[model samples]
Target: MKQKLIFFIAIAICFSSCENKEKNQSVILKGSIQNSNDSVLIFYYSDKSDTVFLSGKNDFRFVLDLKMPVYGYFRINKKTINVFLSPGDSLELKADANRLEEITFSGIGADENKCLSQLSEERTKQEINYEEWFSLDEKQFVFKSDSAYKAQLIFLENLQHKFNNLNPFFTKTEKARIFYTYAESRIAYERSQVFSANSKQKLSPAFYSFQKEINLNDSTMVFIPEYQIFLKTYLDKKVYEQEKNYETMNDLIGAEFDIILSEIKQQQIKNYLLHSVFRDHLQFNGLEGAKDLLALYEKHTTNKKNKDEISSLVKKWQQLLPGNSAPEIALQDELGKIHSLKDFKGKYVFIDFWATWCYPCRREIPHLAKLHKEYSGKNIVFISISIDKQKEAWEQMLKIEKMPWLQLHTTPDAKLLQDYQIYSIPRFVLIDKEGKIVNAQAPAPSEKKLRDMLDMAL
Candidate 1:
């Protein structure tokens, strides 16, 4: 009897120890890759929170300490491999070591397989739609050729929606990344056709819209090499120079330049490139070469008469940089009560420049509301300035959203717009307690980025 009792106690202890060990253990991912050398595979988490690097081996095993289930992208140079994992799960994966031609993942209730299958279906649909659109005869126009541009815009919009829906389902970044490549390829193919100067005028808007769609769909982290190549090929020097519409041309040039500059690291390389492009090629010298053009303008262009005008405009652009002083503006609130920068001297101020018609601006309301609630009575002031032409829309939106922050609007004055260089909507400025600009393109208050800034400021 004594021996039996001792045996029972030992068994209980062993079971309890196993349970505790399992609770503490990390999810194990075991895999093998064939025929690859010195190639690195990087795993990017879905939240963009962390990255893991793995080397190709005959057999590879990785243990991940997961706090929760996650979707991650695996990449070998430019090629992506996507996988899904759950906490306390184990996976066994196999892949072609030579060319990354085939990958097999088994584990965690076939989550990875399900994600890949969905991605495959979406890709097939995208290919079919693209092929069908491109195959259509250019001469066949339901409306005037210029009018048909709208049809292409509609098609691109639909494509964007489809891609957005499909992207989240992809467990691997590679599969999700192919959408941008397809967009680039389609745009490049379309741009290659030589049309009469007159016909090209009609097609230009469509081409621009296509490029915009590609940019809008692109994930900030996922750098598509094909898109970069397409931009370089289609958007040449002459395209930037010959375009007369400064606003649209500036956008195109800036977007393309930003794409290129994002890849380059050395400050000298960037300054040299900017000088060659802006000063030498485009003949645009103002705010061209400086790392923070707005600041350079503010410091150098100060003549008292032009101080208010040029300083404000330069400060606006400066605010676009990460750490810059917020542009100072005195405006009246909805009740016609005047408020100035000095009033919010000792608190962190987030000034959002927006309009009622702007969809992106409106989308930020929920996020702002949540932040306001979370940081209620904190040392932060959230203010929104509307550049809307109609006060009715702004007023109506304020009422509908029940916004608690200080809401102000300016009439449609060219001077005010020019003064602030207000060329874009949904811009935000963050000001610290010292009334200095903390961030110019300070993201909307709803973003975790804003929360982080608040944490630091407070």
Candidate 2:
């Protein structure tokens, strides 16, 4: 009896120690990646992220503090897996890179992960007929999709009930996420039904019966990834239909800002969506319009961190502010003839920084040609500079496309790329006749405003 009492006392002490460690910082993640020799692994919770480089054998161990019941991401190589992280959790994971869908997790945070893994695998199996379903008669499509959604919900319910004993918090949150995910899928199908029913493509009006009542304002549902996407897409579609008279993409985006400000009540999600929209579409239009949208977003958004991020982006963009002298660039033509920006002085230079592999850049060739023709004898020169490493591909495309502009192939030197700060393909820059920058990030030739700006410069 004395020995038994001593053993119990030791066990109690161990439990107490573990509890104290959890209260401090006791998240331990250890894992191995099969078929991977060495790779980088990344994981993150809401505001914190860590990257671990595996040296050999692709084994990893990470210890960090994690807030409980938060959505977290685990990225290995190029594959990403979602996880629910909780404090005091010690998770051991093993995954085969060849068969990524089949993963095994065992430890404190294992039960919920196991359930999620199985559900994903099962859903993939169940969706083997997804291609047929898309081509199915609309009536059959609705019936099958609804049945699948119901099955998913039932499976989620069973999972929550089964895992309730292991981690009630995870079960509750995961179930809610699954439900909202189905809701998002259902809405997407309903929206598609409207399109598919053009002249009655076999879907009865009853196909949309499920969407008659939906809780768009479910604050908690916003946490679901699908709902996050659906909400933004739905808002964009709505704004597109409502704001019929908008001129530029940025103008439509500014109206989207106004719509979100007035309609979206939840400050966090509202600001997040608004900032995302503004940052993406604002620069495609004029700089003054972008500045106006920035001011509008700054005035309305309540997220201070988002405001700071926008401020940083604005500061970065201001590096190409108009009136800044164009960066000095020395590029070579197809025949090994070197040319500098000084050669184009006293002529308005409409420059395209592109690569042979860039599809969008190729698509703009004809438009750039038309602009070149439209502004002939106007003291403006169209300069096409390729960032292609191979001159052969550049020469082949230039021959095939029969581009009339002054085509040059060049590697991106550091100072030129840095001064322009062009991150995306098919970037256009407008230099005034005085050798000063007019619009460092000018509109594309496809955009009518580019012609307007060119005419103004002429």
Candidate 3:
């Protein structure tokens, strides 16, 4: 009986100790912003976000329950500052909205936060002359890049020496950031060389020796932005090297998705890369040829959250499939007259979702005009809808271009944009005479395919 009683007491004590440990792990972040225009502050930690409303005095507080150390950011108005937080950290931050770079920190986690702020300032200085750096020859770039990385490492090391109690996670993640940032710059050199000079200069094998140092499947560094960027650059280089005679860019894109799915062994890293690929594919290429990649993604990815999100996105795009009733959007013409797809129900509609700021949309105007003239008195109509937030800019563009066809305007946040899944500008949609979608993602006017499609429709 005494042994049983002692066992129960021991179990109770263990539970109590665990509960206290968890409570101590909670992070208390309180901050104040001076001369701020925004009422709310956002803290982004990995994939999670916490929004806190600022008080009348422009002060805010966030109590984050965390099991481990994390690198996060505090977004104040248009500017964001880096923050490194650990379990039991109680940090106080102060900044002026106009001068976020001069942010100050205090309290338990103050040293690390201050270090991150200083490091960010140094990174900005390094990138300030990026175009000049990118213009350097391979040898010059390597020398410059190596020197910059060495300086960054020395700077971080000096800070670590200054702050003796800095968390090991912060130091480790900072080192990873420095390493990946250098790696990304090295990988990007080839692209810059190719695009800037339009020359396919053969790079020596020694140029890419940095690639040997990379662990492509580092799941621990997945949340670090620099590491994410390096992985993307590395994958892009790999795809470029492996490119063969392909029928279309879509074929290359499809192969790229397959490469990410097959080559990346780390589950979290795979999830991030796959999610990015799908989102980019959907935005630029639309739903065409996305199914195979989606199926592969579903098979490979074990993240339920990412899987659910991708599934939701796929469902949204599915609504824009051919033969579906065209999404009804209320638009206004130059004179503020309302119009809908129903107004042109008996005419084949070639809709242009564009903005005045879109250069591609401007380039397509001549081709669109020619098509309108050729199809005059035919059973089709060309409609250009401006998604420019500034109504005056849309009106000014219509007047200057003197486009003969129908001109209309809608806000960027219009439900029509959402329904059409219009994330990019210069998006073209084709509707049959009966108001059913012929193609939600139609070929651009500049393409021969568009003329062929129109001829077939007519």
Candidate 4:
């Protein structure tokens, strides 16, 4: 009797384990790619992202725990494939790295994915020729957009019909995407007419009838890429309607933020716009006058993620501010000799961050050469740091150009680039004689402002 009872308890425990395992099964996105050169694939969903590293054999997988179905996209290098993921989905994908457009799906969610692929391809075929569309009059533009919208909507409906088991969330969001895309084009047309062409002819009331359909306060649609774009265009239209004259770019940004705070009531939309405005400001002007605006942003926005990101950027920018000691830069020369910025401490330093592959950087070469020749006798040193991954290309270019300034090579991921916040090529920096930063984002070698700044510093 004791042995039988123990056996019964073991069977009950096994059953319980099986039940828990079934309940805990989340989304399993596994894939294999042939001839893939990338190290990782990025999957983005609902403002969150997950990365799966490719194995030695180029197989990858991501197990995601999701509460509801969401429309997301997988990005490998420059190629993006849309996907619909739901709880309990166990989807598998197969693709050739060279031909990502031909990716195939299997297992659960296969029908919806195949349909999405068709939808993407069809939409591409129906994409508007913006140049041609812009040349048309308001009436013609509206007619063209309306026709396109109708065709796309029909295509989506057909996809839903074909894929009988399509997720409702995916269907709803796809429909929203089609509509928002049309609305964005309409807004773009209106802006072109009013601002670019300066057209005074009153447009027909029917032209803007679509605006009535736009719910500016809707927070549920924030994750849709099309809706996000439409919101931006809509915000620009609202801001431009109020005032167009601004002395500076930051002034324009400030006006945008004011409109966002005062007009937008939805918490999510308001937070998104606020974060966007501040980020743009930071990108363009770097941390100048950003503290006050940041304080206001912290006061208004409840999004801890965006707030933390902005705060982190602010701290990084603080290190690059004028009068602060310049970030240490150590790079190797053509002969593999390490050169430090501190080696030229007694002289003012003008750095030109360039690459052999950058057309704009090459274009500035002659202008930089002229400055170097002119300032050869001055208390300053001109240095060209080549941010090229292939050292051979940089060395070959150096041999061809025979640039007179100190030629150095550094990889793209160097600490020097991050420390100085060098996002783009052909960047210039000016350092004082005492190793202090005069301007982290100094004027270019071709600019008269650079000459003036140098003269004043000397």
lDDT of each: 0.57, 0.73, 0.86, 0.86
Alpha carbon deviation, residue 25, candidate 4 (Å) = 8.7
lDDT by residue for model 2 (207-236), tens: 656555445565555455756776776675
**lDDT score at residue 407, model 4, on the 0-100 scale:** 93
Residue pairs in candidate 1 whose N, alpha carbon or C atoms collide under 3 angstroms: 34-97, 82-172, 319-440, 325-437
- Sorted by TM-score, highest first, which candidate order results? 3, 4, 2, 1
Q: C-alpha displacement of 332 in model 1, angstroms?
A: 1.9
Model 3 residue 296 distance off true place after TM-score fit, in angstroms: 0.7
Query: Residues 142-184, candidate 1, lDDT per residue (tens digit)?
Result: 1233343443344444544544433333323443245445445
Candidate 3 lDDT over residue span 166-267, tens digit each: 888889889989999988888787878867755456778998788788898987798899998888888888787775766765676677777887789888
lDDT of 4: 0.86
Worst 10 residues of 2 by lDDT: 280-289
Q: Give one clash count per candidate, in the order shown.
A: 4, 0, 0, 0
TM-score of each: 0.38, 0.74, 0.91, 0.83
Q: Residue 181 deviation, candidate 1, in Å?
A: 27
Q: Model 3, 299: alpha-carbon shift in Å?
A: 0.6
